[model samples]
Target: MTSDREQGTGGDLVATLIRTAGRRADPPADAYRAVLAAAEDTWQRKVGRRRHWRVGVGIAAAFVLLTAGAALLRVVVLPMMAPAEIARVDRVGGGVATRPAGAGAWVPLVAARRPLHAGTRLRTGPDGRVDLRLEGGVSLRLAVMTEVELHAPDLIRLQRGAVYADTGSAGPGGIVVVTPAGIARDLGTQFELRYAGDVLRLRVREGRVSLQRDAGELVAAAGEQLTIDTAGGVTRGNIARDDPDWAWAETIAPVPDFNDQSVAVLLEWVARETGRPVHYADAAAEQRAASVILHGRVGPLAPLEALGVLLSTTDLTYEILPDGTIEVRYQ
Candidate 1:
């Protein structure tokens, strides 16, 4: 019962509301694309952050490992690699060599002035002899069938044999010789220490030495000899410094390099070797010796024998006094 114009207007209004509602329910294609792009961007950012975190962790781990390795090298590896040199092998006669620490086989050591490190074990054949020059001008002579260990520059262990130590003028920093029976400590002295089966002997040539055992201790001065028995009993007696028993030591004594050295220097060496003071016939004789320069080699000769050869070049002769003094005079 309504007019046609009113009915047409009402239909148009209804259609317009329906179109607006459809547009609100379904978004445009551009808006859907923008939402997908934002989600993809957020996912890519999260992946990048995780990758950066892994790289940072790896770098930190490597640094820690490097630091730990360096510390280990400094503390343990370097020290084991570098053992200190305490002595030098000056001479090796017969079949003298060294048995390295923790090694069973013996290695033949040639006389090439090889450096000897601490804890090196030395062994000699039946006819062997070896001479060692320790730090601080000390000399150690080992006789045949002897075995010794270098504990330090100022210390040695006499396992089984004889050793002559001359700690020349280097004030003793506790030079010790460890024997099976006892220990002999030098007081800036020259001495011979022998260790055999269940016995140890010490003979002081110049200066004092202290021998210690579980029983007690005794000091032996120059020209004194002490023996320590297996039972730790100590016995001491007088012995000449130049006794014939010491002749073997003289035979193996180290010959000084007298190149371009003064005669006075040579005389001083002879005095030390022979354990005697040199007496010049007069002040002129001493002055002449100071002015003269010696040239030649006294190779492999005993001290007295070498002295005779040396004086034969000049018009000088020597006589050994009863008091162990050498009187040098013009022929």
Candidate 2:
């Protein structure tokens, strides 16, 4: 019933349709490409998440290390400055007026002499007073009801209150006191400075006091004074003290223990007596046949001065602290 040409054309058409259906049942080239692209995207997302986690962990570790380093700086590094190293004192802050060595209330402007350590408590009543004197005779005195921090050998940061200073005889680099506002450098011999009420008050007695700002420097000479505000603004004038507070320096007593014992034994005794810590150089030499003639406080004073006196005794040398610890060596 069918013609030959019609039958052959229909068969060719059916064969073409079967071939197309087989290709569609499997995947086309574009479909393979789409699947590959999806796999790559998922891998990339996983990699991104891993990188983010690593970065976050790294940041956390860095934060912990930084915090630990700061604590070490405050507790260890700041206090280790040499005995010969110079220091400054200033006021920081306190919720109450006065706290003691265990109050955890105040921070010093410079490393404290025996009774003071970083974790020690600080108190300032309206009449609370504190003083710091470097081995080379630089001194800083905090007024009553003040708080401060001893940040470095030459750096002190005052948070609140007032401080008087006689920055004298610190070798070479001298002394520096920092406040909530600015820094005061000793170009002169003596100065009484107060950081309170957003004002830096300066009264110069003996030498010159230099008020330095980020912008410039203001020089105050003997009998002259200046005040600087938090804004780097400075005011200059003449200020004087009838009886300078330096009278305390005169009260420093001499060590008289050297009269009975050799300078070496004296140093050891002073170290044990005063309770200030001490270190020795050339321990054998310090213990050798060392003798000295005695004089005033240099003779009867604390161990530090006693060591100084012993050194004054022959070719020997020594060092002592305000708290009486002494270290000595014979030449």
Candidate 3:
């Protein structure tokens, strides 16, 4: 059933396709040449007796396979090696700026525009503060005029700024902050680490923190502060959980995802964030707190302010002591 006209048109199309592939495609010169040479050799040996048009088809098929494979790697493999999402800005106060991994000018942080990756440098303006959420429920807050580098998921370098961290009680996650003076690591706790000039301050609001330096390692428990100087001299002091020094951090504490949560959950969060121990006036109060549930957003208010607003809805009364202990009462 084959006709001369059909064979002539098909031959012309195959010849044009082979010539276009060679002229337009820009593949690896050596690889392209090698593949073409092998394909042509095979065509000559096996299809030598066949019509010349079939030879053009075989060569074009070889080029398609090569380019298709290269396209596959470009679409699939390259993306796998790109930087991953490591952190995100949860709260922004005033002016916050960040620089990417490469050397460049620090640009104003676009709130939630994109996820933050490691090696990114961020700093706050004189009146700026920010809260960043890392993987595993770790909260990092940067104070005004602080510069830090997100070195890794669990590590940050406090170049010359103050950073507060709160590792949630529900997880085993913690963060290590490195400074010129020493390295401070949290012990399942909420704490602050600040490096200013020749001094590095490590304050533990709840749980404990440890400092590792060239000389040795020292631990500071709750309500304790350790000042490490450039000369490596460590001085110990006391800082209350609800001290005025922590007011800035309190203002920027990561707001809980408090949707339809129990009153006890909010109470416990306030107590923990303010570094106050929680105590119920009686068994009835504890049970009442657990019974009541909350709805809607808490806004961006500080922990104490949010607690006050939420507690006013319920008949429960609460008291905060001088030592930062919060007592809840049903009456």
Candidate 4:
């Protein structure tokens, strides 16, 4: 029942749609595969980039953590490992300084009676000196412009300058001093070890000292001085117990308790310290010394000065001979 012109237009439109559909016959299977492959490649590229970024971030975080841990170890853990106390500072004079075992800024160490530990480094400035008492009644004395490290109760590293050690009358052989040149082993001795200008000097005030070196072992007896140069050259010299070279040690000698002590006791102490022999004019003089008792403190006077002051208090006089002999006589 449609009009003839409308029917004709509809038929032409249908024919044109059929021709267009035939020309576009469903996309080829190869083209569909290509599109899918392109999409997968694009996804992988984006994911790989993200994965790489994540890995970079992880590495950076790990680096930061390691750096912080190292800092913490140095700042906290290392300092907490306290050194063991093996000695005490009996006397510290002048510009004396102290530092920790391996690394630290030098700081003033002025207070006496301060505890000194192993691994402590001590250095003295001009006019500086120190006196220390180690285990076993050993006396350790440092000289001016000296640097040393307390390795143990019986071991010391003399880097520069001089150190004097007195192992007492019994002289238990447990002390040794080390230097760049050699090791000085204490054979129950009172000795001074000095290192300067690549030279190692050992002067035995009493007993003996031995050096263990790569070349051979050399022994130094009492009243002997051993000099070992950088070239391993050895030289021997004689030293007097009362030599002026030992005057420095005398100045820094620890003061003894003088209160209520006998004159005889005082004389013995003085003779022992001065490296001199003590004699009496007679038996009566000896009896008098033992009988008299001294009272009050002598302060920090040197051994000789205290002897003079203490003798003045009693009816006793003393004389020191050129041969390092002390003669006590009744006044």
Each model's total of backbone clashes: 0, 38, 0, 0
Name the 10 consecutive residues with the lowest summed lDDT in model 2: 88-97
Instruction: Report residue 84 deviation for candidate 4 (angstroms).
Output: 1.3
- Estimate the TM-score for candidate 3: 0.72
Candidate 3, 1-331: lDDT as tens digits: 5454577988778877887878665786434533443344335434643454355457797865665566456545643676545688888889899998875898998575257886789999999999998866688999999999885667787878899998885243378777766777788888999988758899998888878765778998988999987677889999988888998998988888877999899988888788677999899999999999887887889998999898888889888876678989997
Q: How far is candidate 3 from the true structure (C-alpha RMSD, Å)?
A: 20.4
Lowest lDDT sum, 10 consecutive residues, model 3, at: 33-42
TM-score for each candidate, following the candidate numbering: 0.73, 0.42, 0.72, 0.73
Best by lDDT: 4
lDDT of 4 at 194: 93
RMSD of each: 30.3, 24.6, 20.4, 27.7
What lDDT tens digits, residue by residue, belong to model 1 across residues 1-331? 5454576978777877887778565775434533443343336545865576567667897865665576567446865997668888877788887976667888987774799887789998898888888887788889888999886677787878899888886777446777656667888888999988768899999999987665667889999988877666778888887677777677777788877887788889888877878999998888888877888777777788888888888777789998878998865
Q: List the global CA lDDT of all models.
A: 0.78, 0.53, 0.80, 0.80
Rank candidates by lDDT, best first.
4, 3, 1, 2
**lDDT of prediction 4:** 0.80
| Residues 1-331, model 2: lDDT tens digits | 5454576988777877887778556675434533443344346545865576567666797765666576566546865752223332222222223333345553333332333333222335564565555444556666666666543344555656765655545643365666544566777466666777777787776677776654666778877878877666777787443333433322232223345556555555444333344556675664463444443334224344555545565666655544444445556
Candidate 4 lDDT over residue span 178-293, tens digit each: 77667787898888999897788999988888886658889999999999887889999999887879877777777778788889989887775677789999999999999998
Which has the higher lDDT value, candidate number 3 or candidate number 4? Answer: 4
